[model samples]
Target: MYQPPHFKEERLDVQHALIQAHPLGLLVTNGSSGLIANPIPFALDASASPLGTLRAHLSRANQQWRDFDPAQEALVVFQGVESYITPSWYEAKRETGKVVPTWNYVIVQAYGRMRAIDDPEWLLRQISDVTRHQEAGRPEPWSTADAPADFLAAQLKGIVGVEIEVTRIEGKWKVSQNRSDTDRQRVAAGLRDDAHEEAHAMADLVETRGAKS
Candidate 1:
């Protein structure tokens, strides 16, 4: 991850928060199968390690798990709010016509040694934890116990659990922080007016994160 000083997010809590909010991460590994990437939903246990621990499951048929190399580290990328920033939104565009379009986003990258677990007990716990996290806000939440025992057991046989003790993590929040105050404010206003959920989220980031500039 490129780290420009102005955009770096160094707080561990902030990094973990982004991962929890965007649990679906792009798991990247380089092993016998070469570079392979899969989109997997993960559960983060902040207390599990100094950095954190990531728990996820992959279909038994997915070769990525089998290709895991203990000698190499794995990377999981979590992407948060992202939106396009138009030059038209910058006051500098009108003042000097020197502004260019760019992107505003928040993202976190976690790197750690990969471990694959085939034990049924671990798999059960991994799935339950992930399920509980995702269903937390729902009016009618579902649970792994809701399924028939035999059926759930049979289904669990088809997947494998993965755990990664995150050793390194990086966060970048590029929310118009490089722009001048007037330009950043104008960008936020334009994003808010777009009336889209993601754009509005980016607008809030611009207001809060860019304010530190």
Candidate 2:
């Protein structure tokens, strides 16, 4: 993550919140075959480490897990609200015609040594936690316990548990903080009018930053 001073988000609470909101992470690792990345949903356990620990699962058929070495480091990237910022949304564009388009987004990169667990008990708990977290917002939540014992057991056998004790985390929140108040406000307004989830999310974040200033 190339984090400029103005864009870096160092607050632990904020970082955790972003990870929670964006549970899916791109797990990246290097092996003899070369670099491989897989998108996996993670469960965060803050108590596991100062930076936090990530829990996930990979398909047993996925060679990346088998190829991954415990001694090597892996990176998990979590992306939050993101949207394109057009020059038309900037007041400075009209004032000086110098502003160009850019992007506003939030992202967190976690680096740590990954451990692969084949224990059925650990796998059960890991999948249960992930399902519970993701299903919480639904009108009718689903659970691993909903399946029959034999069926769930067979399903669990097809995956392996993954855990990472995070050693480092980098957070970047590029939310128009570099722009003037007027320009930032205009950007927010433009995003809000776009009527897309990501756009509205970015707009809210930009507006929140303005309020703090």
In TM-score terms, which candidate is top? 1
lDDT of 1 by residue, 153-194 (tens): 999899998899999999999998888899888998999999
The C-alpha lDDT values of all candidates are 0.92, 0.90
**Tens-digit lDDT string for candidate 2 (18-101):** 999899999999888889999999999988889999999999999888887678899999999899999998776777998788
In terms of TM-score, how similar is model 1 to the real structure? Answer: 0.97
Q: Which candidate number would show the highest lDDT if scored against the true structure?
A: 1
Clashes of 2: 0
- Which residue pairs in candidate 1 have backbone atoms (N, alpha carbon, C) closer than 3 angstroms, thus clashing? none
Residue 126 of candidate 1: its Cα lDDT?
Answer: 86
For candidate 2, the lDDT comes to 0.90
